[model samples]
Target: MSLYQFGKNLVLVLFKPIYRMEVHGRENFPKSGSVLLCSNHIDNLDPPIVGACTPRMVHFMAKEELFTIPVLGKILLKVGAFPVKRGLSDREALRKGLKVLKDGEVLGLFPEGTRSKDGQLGKGLAGAGFFALRSDALIVPCAVVGPYKPFKKVRIYFGKPLDASEYRERKVTADEMTIVIMEQIRELLEKHR
Candidate 1:
C-alpha cells in the first residue's frame, strides 16, 4: 500500500473509533480530479480525523515548524504533507498547493489558519481565498464538530462544492471568496453543533 493509504488507515483504526467519529455528507466528495477541503480547525488531531474519514488522500500544507521535528517531518512527507511558513506570504507553499491541484490530487486547508481555542469557526484568511481562486479545483466546505472527549461522538460534515468558477470568472477579490468560504463552514457548524 502507499504511505498515504497506510497512514490514513492507521488513523482510521486509531483515531476514528477512539473518538467515536461520525462522518456525514461524504457523498459530496468527488471521485477524481482536484479538490480543496476547507475546514475549521479545533485541535491538532483535526487534520488526521478529517483526512482519515475521507475517501481520498488529503495533502495538507502543515506549518513549517512541524517539518523540523526529525522523525515526524519524515512521516509527514511520507503521508504527502508539505510545509508552509505561517503568517508570511510564502509563495513557495502556494506554488506547491496549486501544483497539487494541477496534478488532480486532493488538498486540505484550514481557512482560519490556526486551531480555534473555543472550537468556533473563525474568519478565513485571505490567503485561502487566493489559493482557491488560483486553481480550477472544486472548493468543498467541511466542518469538524468537536469537543473531542474520548469515546465521545465527534461529527464531521462535508458540504457540496461552492461555485468557485463563478468567483474565479468574475475576478473577485480574495476577501470575497474568503467570506463565502467561511460562511459555508459556519453554516455547517451551526447545523451540526
Candidate 2:
C-alpha cells in the first residue's frame, strides 16, 4: 500500500474504537472520476476521520499555517494534503485543488472554510463552488456530527453527490454557487441530527 493509504488505515484502526465511528451513506461515493467531498467542519479531527472512512484516497486542503510546522509539514505532504491560505483568496491553492480534480482524483475540503467551534453550520466559502464549476466535479455533501471525544459515537453521513453539470455551462457566480453548496450541507446535517 502507498504511504497515504497505509497511514489512513492506521488511523482508522486507532480511531474507530476510540470514537465509535458510525458511517452512513458511503454508497453515495462515486467509485471513479473527479469528486469534491464537501463537508461541514466541526473539529480538527474531521479531515483524518473523513479520510479514514472513505474508500478513495482523499486529498485535503489544509490551512497554510499547518504546512509551516517542522515535522508536521512533511507528514502532511506525505499524507496527500496541500496548503491553503485561510482568509483571502489563494489562487495557488485553488490551482492545486483544480489540478487534483482535473487529474480525476478525489479532493476533500470543508465548505465552511474553517472549523465551527460551536458545531453549528456556517456559511460556505466560494472556493468549493469555484472548484466544482471549474473542474465540473461531482460534489458529495458529507455531514460529520460529533463532540469528538472518546466513546462518543461520532456520526458521518455522506449524502448524494451534487452534480455540477447544471452549473458548468452556465455563468453562475461563485457566491451564488456557494449558497447552493451550503444549503446542501445544511440539509445533510439536519438529516443526521
Clashes per prediction? Answer: 0, 0
TM-score of each: 0.97, 0.97
| Model 1 misplaced regions, further than 4 Å | none
Runs of candidate 2 with Cα error greater than 4 angstroms are: none
Local accuracy of candidate 1 as per-residue lDDT tens digits, 129-188: 887899888888899988899999899999998768999989899999899899999999
Q: What RMSD, rounded to one decimal, does every model reach?
A: 0.9, 1.0
Worst 10 residues of 2 by lDDT: 167-176
Candidate 2: what lDDT?
0.90
Error (Å) of candidate 1 at residue 96 is 0.2
Candidate 1, residue 79: the lDDT equals: 90
Query: TM-score of the candidate numbered 1?
Result: 0.97
Report the lDDT of model 2 for residue 124: 88
